[model samples]
Target: MPTQSDSTPTESARLLGRTRPAVRIAGYSAVLRTRALLTLAVLIAILCTLFALDISTGEFHIPLGRVLDVLGGGGSRAQRFVIFDSRLPRALTAVIVGAALGLAGAITQSILHNPLASPDILGITSGASCGAVLILAGTGGATTGIAATLGIPLAALAGGLLTAVAIYLLAWGRTTTGDHGVMGFRLVLIGIGVNAALLSVVSWLLTRATLTDAAHAQLWLTGSLDRSDWSTLVPAGIGLGITLLIAAASSRTLAALRFGTDTTRVLGVRIQTQQALLLGAGVIAAALATAAAGPVGFVGLAAPQIARRLLRTPGEPIVASTLIGAIAVVGADLVSRTILPVDLPVGVVTAAVGGPFMLYLLVRANRKATL
Candidate 1:
């Protein structure tokens, strides 16, 4: 009973409505993909620039041309020594450590479903610190003849892994019924307690140790790139590779898990298994990075949060997080080296930046929850 003209216009309107969502979705998808690629490209450029600066801007002042020549295997002996002996190892260490911290932060945030739930937040870093402090203190504060350097990192890794396992076990409620927020809160409390206890132990050890040993221990606690050679780089690289592989493989599961256990389980995902694997991987990444870099605080805490804001997504931005983290740690290291005449610690720089950001996040989250 409708006129042809009216019917034709109605049909057109219906078609437009149906096609609009698809068009918008496609547009958004393209934008996200483009942004991700651009971010990665920018990060790579930044990393390369930082590496070159690290090589050329040091006290010896190696030329850019020579730095490139050394990189390409065509430089003089002095250039090779400067690039290889001084710059390459530090740069490589920064990249690996940053990548690990970023990935670990992303995984912890996603799995725990809390923006504040990073390795540092959940106590993994504190656990590692406890172990490192124990070794340094137990050796009477002397790294010179006590094999403390080798023992400390190992202890840190072990302590972090154990703490992670304990948290997971405690969070399991016969079938993983606890809310992620509750679990995260519990872990944070435990971590604080652990950290306090360890600090006390370290204080006791310092009092009993030799002055030289105490000074060495204090320096280690501050964190530095001076100890990062091929030896530290190799182990960190291996651990980072393994962590990234696990994260990539379990990404889908993590994405699903973000929507709550019931939804994830309904979609045929094994919630507990995936959670355990992700947590384990996070602990390993954090522990290795901590062992290498002396609890380089806030890289793990800040990287994923920054990635989430940049990507503007609900779930984990693994790729973005990794790149952002790499940029952050390397950038901080550059600042630490160049900004201060005396060379401040990398951990101190990260903490100084991260601590305020953390407060902002807490305030923002509180406002959102109230609304």
Candidate 2:
């Protein structure tokens, strides 16, 4: 019995109400999909740029065309040797170390639900540093030599694994859920203690060593890509690839863990098992990277944070982190080599850049907490 105009207004309102939710949902879906696609494209482009930069920018500059020819197996002997022999191993090593650190950071951050968590947070870097220092102090020669190469990497792995196990054990307390229960705060506290103790040991050893050994140890501690050879590259590449695959596969479980351990358990994720696996993977990744380069700092801490921001995702994106990490290290290495007249240590450069960013993050987090 209502007038036609009145009925028309009511119908229009109903149509808007029905369509609004649909439009909003469609818009959200489109945004998410677009973000994912953009992340992928950025990753691909960055990788290509890294490869080009690695081959083209060095003391003996190779033209882009010749670099491509070398890559394609159609270059002169000199070009092939420079590209394949000299640069390829170091470039590949950078990628392996960078990806490993990035993935490790992503896993640690997700599991801890703390953006500050990284391989260093668990004392892995400190452990590796201790091992390398010991080898340099104890072994009476260049720590980067063929003999020390085998010993150093093994020692680093052993040190990292031992430190991780110790932290896990010390943090574990009896709980109804399981025998090994970790209190996050307690774990972090213990890791700090371990890191401090290991650093003290390294300092003592450095003082006792000869001047030559001390200098070599200092360079290793600062971190460098100067000595990466086929020997270091092959093992690092194999380990990095394996760990990256595992991290990617665990992304779903990691996402569930952001809620809480109990929620992850409710979702049928093996919380304890996954935690152990991820921690172990993170330690191994960090260890291999340390051995390949030398405690290359901040890649593990900064790469994941940057990746999350770039992707604009709420939770950690492991794949995106890996890509961003690769870009970060390669880019940093390029800067270290080209920006400075003399070669700068990669670790020094990362620390210089990441140190400020870390302080800013800490301040922001503190302000938010106070508010």
Candidate 1 wrongly placed segments (more than 4 Å) = 1-32, 137-152, 174-182
For each candidate, what is the lDDT? 0.76, 0.80
Candidate 1, residues 1-371, lDDT tens digits: the string is: 76756667678888776652222464543223556566768777877788677767677778888788778998878878888987888888888888888999998888777777888777787777777777765664444323534565578789899878776666544435744423555655665565566666666767776776677667767766777777667666777899889987877788898886678779999776787888888888888787777777788888888888776778768888887787777887888888777788788888889999999989999999999
- TM-scores of the candidates are 0.85, 0.87
Q: Judge candidate 1 at residue 257 and give its lDDT.
A: 83
- In model 2, how large is the Cα lDDT of residue 269? 88
Off by over 4 Å in 2: 1-32, 140-149, 174-180
Which has the greatest lDDT?
A: 2
Q: Write the per-residue lDDT of candidate 2 for residues 1-371, one digit (tens) a residue.
A: 76756657678888766652222464443223566777779797988787688878887899988888889989889888888888988888888888889888888888877777787766888898787678867764354556555777787888889988998899788644564577566777888788888888888889999988887788778878887788887666766877877777786777887776667778998877888898888888888788788888888888888888887888778888888777777887888888877789888888888899888878988999999
Q: How big is the positional error of residue 156 in model 1, measured in Å on the Cα after superposition?
A: 2.1
CA lDDT for candidate 1: 0.76
**Considering summed lDDT, which 10 consecutive residues are worst modelled in model 2?**
22-31
Clashes of each: 2, 0
